[model samples]
Target: MSAGTGQRAAAPGPSTQKPRGIDRVLAFVERAGNALPNPVVLFTVLFGVVAVVSTALALADVSVTVPGTDDTKQITGLLTGAGVRWLVENLVTNFAAFPPIAAVLLMIMAVGVAERAGLLETAMRATLARAPRAFLPYLVALVACQAHMMSDVAAIVLPPLAAVVFKSAGRHPAAGLIGGFACVTAGYAAGFTIGSLDALYTGITQQAVAVLSDTHHADVNILANYFFTAASSLVLGLIGGFLISRVLEPRLPAYTATADAPDASESEDIRLTPAERRGLLCTGLVVAVYAAVVLSLWLPNGAPLRGEGGALVPSPLLTGIVPVLFGGFLLAGVTYGFTVKTLSGSEGVVAAMTDSVKNMSGYVVMMFVAAQVIAVFNWSNLGVLLAVKAAALLKSVGLTGFGALVAFILLVSCLNLVILSGSALWSLIGPVFVPAFMLLGMSPALSQAAFRIGDSATAVITPMNPYVFLLLALLQRYEPEARLGTLISRLAIFVVPFLVAWLGILAVFYGFDLPLGPGAGISLK
Candidate 1:
C-alpha cells in the first residue's frame, strides 16, 4: 500500500452528467471576480472614495458620540488644506510604517534563503516519502496547511509536487493538485505555528482595536489565534483528506501521464544527499539553540521578557515576536544554506535576502495604495463612525451574541470572493468590525478568529485569489483542456463542508467560552 494507491484503487468510473448547478454558480463567481479591478487599483479607488465621502460627511457636519463617552467625534474632510498637508506629510511614513508589509518582507528574507538552498523542497519530499499510504492525503493536507509559514512558497511549490506524488502512485494527478491547492489556499488561515500571517493580521487587528479606546491598546500577539487555528488545521486536514480521498479522486477521469508530467524517476531521485542531510542537521541545531535562548529569556522567574507586574500578555517576548521570528528564521536558513553550499559566503546570503525583497515588488506596490487608503480611512473617522452606527443598529435589531458572529463570518466569507488578500481585507474591514464587535462585548481576538474563518474557507473557489491562476497553470500540465471552472469545481466541494465544520467549531468555542489563545478569550472583560 504505497502512498496515493488507495485513491487510485478506489477511483469510480466516470459520470456522464455534469454538476450544472455548482458549475453555473462557480462560472458566475469566476466571471464576477475576474471583472474586479486589480487589488492595487481597487485600493486606489477606495482611497478616492474615502476622501470624497469624508469631504461630504464633513460638509454635512456628521458626528457620532463615542460609545461610553459624552464627547462627539466629527468626520475630518480629507479635501481640506489641513488634510492635504497631513496626507503629504504621512504618505511616505504610512507605506514605510505599515506593519504587515514590513513584517512580511523581513520574514521572506529568511524564507528565501531556505527556499533557495532547496531546504524547503527537500524537507517536503523527505516528509512525503515517509508518509503512510493509508494516510497520504491527510499528510499532504497537513503539510499544505503548515506551508503557510513559508508564505507563497507553498502555492508555487506544492501543487506540482503533490501531482507528482499522486501520479507515481497511479492516482489522478489532478486530484492531488486540487487537494494540495485546497489546503494551501482554503486552509490558509490555519497553521500549526505562528508565521508571517499571524504577525501581519495581529498588526492590523491592533491598529483597529486602538481606534476605539486607549485602554484597548494592548498589543495583539501574533499567536492570538494560535489555539483555535491549531485546532482548525487538524479539522481542515481531516476534512480535506476525506474529500480528496472519497469525493474528488473518485470523480476525476483516470490519469494518463503526459510528457509534461514530472518524470517518474524524479520522485525516485528525491533522496537527500549527505550535504543536504548535514544542512538539515545544522538547521535543526541552530533552531534548537535559538529556541533555548528565547525560552531562557521568557520562562525563568522574573525574566526580562515578562510584562510589568509579571504579566505575560503584554510581555516583551510577545510584543517583540516579529524581530524574534526574523532572527530565528535568518539563523536557521543561513545554517542550512552554508551546510548545503547554496550559500558560499555572506555575499550569497545577501543575494538571497535581496531576491526575497525583489519578489515582493508587487506587494510593495499594492501596499502603497493600501497604506494611503487606510490612512485616509483613519483620518476621516469614517470607520469609527460606521462602527458606532452599525453597533447601534445591531443592538436595535437584537443581532448580538453567537448569531451575530455567525453573520459576520458569512459576510466576510462572501467578501472573500471579491477580495483575495487577507491582510488587505483585514486592514479595510478590521477597523469597522473590531470596534463594532467590541461594542457588542466580543474581544478583538474573537473577532479576528471569526474573520479568519471567513477569509480562508472560500479562498480555493474564488478566482480573485492570485494563486488560483497559478494552480490552473499547474493543472494544465496534466489535463491540457482544464479550465478555471475545472479547478474551482473540484476544490469547491470542500468549501461548504469546511465552512460548516469551521463555523460549528466556532460555535462550540463560544458555547464553552474557550480561550482562543493564551490570554485571549471570546469576550472582552
Candidate 2:
C-alpha cells in the first residue's frame, strides 16, 4: 500500500447517508486531527526542552526563585551546572525505582506472546462481535480498562476498534472512537478489578506519610478500592455510554465526507488442535489453582492482604501488590505462550521479552523527564509548601468528606492541564492531604480514591494526557476537519456526567461508611 493510502479489508456495505449529520461531524474531526502537532512528539520535545532550559537556568542562577525561599538556598541550584549529570542519573534511578514500569514490563512479556500467537487480537475482536447490543458499551469500557493491565493496549488498539464498532452499529464512527478512547484513557486510573493504580498511589501515599511522621503505621494498601471501584466502574461506564449516545452524539456535527473504512484484519485464529486445547485448558486450570492458593494466604488471621490482626486495611498483601500483579500477568502470558505454538520454544519467550522492553522507549523518555520535574520540585521543597498550605486552607474552611472530596477532584482536574502524571500530582499532594484527612476521621485509601476521581475524570479534556492527542490523530483518519476544540467540546458534555456520577457514588460510599474493598474502609476507624 502507498504511504498515504488508507488500509482496507472488506468494508461493510454503505448505509443510507445522513448528509446533514454524522458525515459533517466526521469531516470536522479528521481536519482537526491533521491540524494538530503530533502530541507524543510535541510532549516529548517540550519535556526535553524544558528540562534542558530549567537545568541551564538553574546553573546560571537566572531562574526565578519562588518567593519566601532564600535565593541562594533554593535558586542557586545545581539543576543546570553540576546538577545536570546528577539529574540524569537520578532520573535513571527514579525510572528504575518506579514499580509501574516493572509492571508494564511484566504485562508486555505475556502480551507480546499473546499478540504474536494472534490469540489476544482474535479474542478481542471475537468478544466485541459477540457482545450483546445492550451490553456492548459496557463491555467496551471493561475491555478498555483491562487494556491497562496490558501495556499501552488502549493507544494502539482501541481507537481503530472503536471506529469499527460504531460503523458496524450504524452510528457515527467518530462517536464510538471517541467514547471508547474516553472510557479507556479517562478511566485509566479506576481499574479496581486489578491492582495497578491502586498499588502505585498507596505506596506513594505511605511513603509520603513516612516522610512527614517517620512511622510504618502510615502504610496504605494498593487494592484499597478494589470492590468499591470495581462496582463504581460499572456505574460510571453506564454513564459514559449514556453520555456518548445522548449528549455527545447530538453535539457532534454531520460529516461532510465519507472516509473509507479500514478493512478489519485478524491473525489466523489458532484453532488449538484438540491436544493444544487440552494443554491450554490445563494451563488455565493450574492458574486458577495458583490464584486461589495465593488469595487464601491473605484470608488467614493476620495475612498482609489483611489489615492488622485480620483487618484488610494496611495489609502487607496490599502494600506488596505490584509483585502479585506482575506474577499474575507473567503466569498467564507464559502459560498461554508455552502451551500454544505462540511460544513455539524457549527462544520465542526470550524474543517476547525483548519486544516488550523495546516498546518501553516512549515511556522511558516520558519517565526520565517526569522524574526530573518531580525531583526538582521536591528538592526545592516547593511541592511540600504548596501542599501544606493547600491542606491548611481546606481544613480551615472545614472541608471534609464528600464536599472536600468534590473540591479536591475539581482542583486536580484543573491542575491536570499543567501536570498530568497521576503519581506526580499525588506525590505532591499525598504528603499533605493523606495525613490531614486521616486526622479528620478519613483514611488514606479514601483520600487517594478522591484524588483518583479528579485525576481520571478530566483526563480526556487535559492536553497533558499522554494519549489524548493520539486519539486526535486517529480522528484524522476518518474526519479530516476536526480540531482540538472540537474534540474537547464534544468531550465536555461528558465532563459533567462523569464528575457528577463519580462524585455521587463516592458521596454515598462515604456517607454510608462503606468498605471500598475487603479491608478498604471509607473512614479512619
Candidate 3:
C-alpha cells in the first residue's frame, strides 16, 4: 500500500536560461498579483472609482436604451447630494441584503460545529483507511471534489490531511498537497449535490436577470446548474487525479519530513475511536430522519415544499435551501457532538456557533465594502448600460450564440487571475453578462454555467486566490523551500486540460438541449 514504491526521480532545479513563454507569463502574474492591494482594500478603491466615474458620466448625460424596452436610462451620479443621501440611508440595508452573506454565514455556523467536533476529521480517516494504495490519489481527488458541500471547510482541512495521508503511505506529501488543492479549487464550482455556493450564486444570478426582463421570470432555483456541475465533479476528479499522479508527482522532490511535518505514526490512530463510532452512527440516523421528513413534504402530490401548481422551480425547497442547510448540518452536528462529548449540553453547541461567527469577522468587513460597490454600480445604471452596449457591440461583430459563449468563458478565465473572490467577481460582471447572453437567446443559467467553469479552472494557478498562499504555507511544512511559483507551476499542468474538458462538457449539454437542472435549460424560450 505504499505510494512511493516506484516513485520517479525528482525534477531538475530551475534553469539559468531565459524563461519560456508560459513561465514568463506566470512570473508576471505572480508579480502583478503580489503588487495588487488586499481584496477588501481593492473593493474600497473600486467604490471610490465608481463614484467618481458615475459623477463624470452623469455630468455628460450618458445614457443607454434598455434592451426590449423603449425607455432610456441615465447614470445617477453617486457623488451628488441626492445620491449621497440614498447611500447613507441604505448603507446598513445594503450589507444586510447582499444575497450571499446571510446564506454563507448560516451554512458556516452549522458546519462549523461538525468541524469543531472532529466529525470531519474522523470521516476522512475512516474513508482513507479502507481505500487501496493505488487508488489513493483518485480517491482523495474524488472526495475533495464532493467536499464542496461543506463550503470552505474542505479547502482548509483537506490539504494538510492529504499530506499526512500520502506521507503515511510513503509517498511525496507535496504531491498529495498539490492534488488536494487542485481538486478543491479547480473543482470548486462542481459538487455532487447542491450546496451553499449554489444558493449564493443563484441569488446573484436572479438579481442580475431581474434587471433585464421580468416577463419571462421563473425562480432561479438553487439547483439551476445541478446536473452539469454534478457531472463536472466526476470529470474533474478523474482528470485531476491522473495529473497529480502522472505529472505532478514526478516533478516534486522526494518528501523529507521535518519537525513541523505531520507525523506518519499518527495515521495509525486516525481510525474512529469507540465514542466517535457511536457519534457517527447517531449522526447518520439523524441525517436519515431529517431527509425523510423533508422528502415527505416534497415527493408527494400537492406538497407544501412544491410551489403553487406543484412547480419545483418555484418551490419552497429551492428558495429555502439555505435554511435547510443550516438545519440539516445543525441536527447532524449536534447529534455527533453530544454523543462524542464534544458538546456537553445546549451551552456547548451555542459556544461552537459563537466561535464560528467570530471566524467570519473578516468576511463581514469585506462584504461591507463589496455591498457598497455593488449598490453604487447599480444606482449609477452602469451595469445595465454596459450590458446593453456590450450586447449591441457583439451583435455588430456577429459574435452570437456559441462563439459568444466561448468568448465569455475565456474572458472570465482571464479575469479570475486578477479577481479572486467568485462572489465579488460575479457581482461585478454578472449583471452585464447574464442579461447580455439572455438577449442572445441564452438562459441566465447557461451564462452562470460558463462563468463557473471559467472561474474554477484557473483558480488553482492564480496567486490572487487567497487559498494559494495558504497552500504554499502548508507545502512549506513538508518542503520548506516551496515557493508560490512551485505550486503555480504544478497547478498550471492541469488548468488547460481542466478548462478544455469542462468547456467540452458544456458544449455537449448545449448540443443535446439538456436541462441544466430542474426546469432550467440552455436557451431562452
| Quality of model 3 by C-alpha lDDT | 0.80
Q: Give each prediction's root-mean-square deviation over alpha carbons.
A: 5.1, 7.9, 4.7
lDDT of 2 by residue, 238-325 (tens): 8777777776656667744354445333212212355455545755686798789778878767554676667654566666666776
Q: Write the per-residue lDDT of candidate 3 for residues 206-296, one digit (tens) a residue.
A: 7677656533454566778989998988988898888888888988887676997877786766567889889898899999999999988
Error of 2 at 336 (Å): 2.2
Model 2, residue 37: C-alpha shift (Å): 17
Arranged by TM-score, best first? 1, 3, 2
All candidates: TM-score: 0.91, 0.70, 0.89
Candidate No. with top TM-score: 1
Deviation from native of the Cα of residue 332 in model 3, angstroms = 1.0
lDDT of each: 0.81, 0.61, 0.80
Worst window of 10 by summed lDDT in candidate 1: 1-10
* Candidate 2 regions with alpha-carbon error over 4 angstroms: 1-123, 249-259, 263-284, 296-316, 358-389
- The 10 consecutive residues of candidate 2 with the worst lDDT sum are 1-10
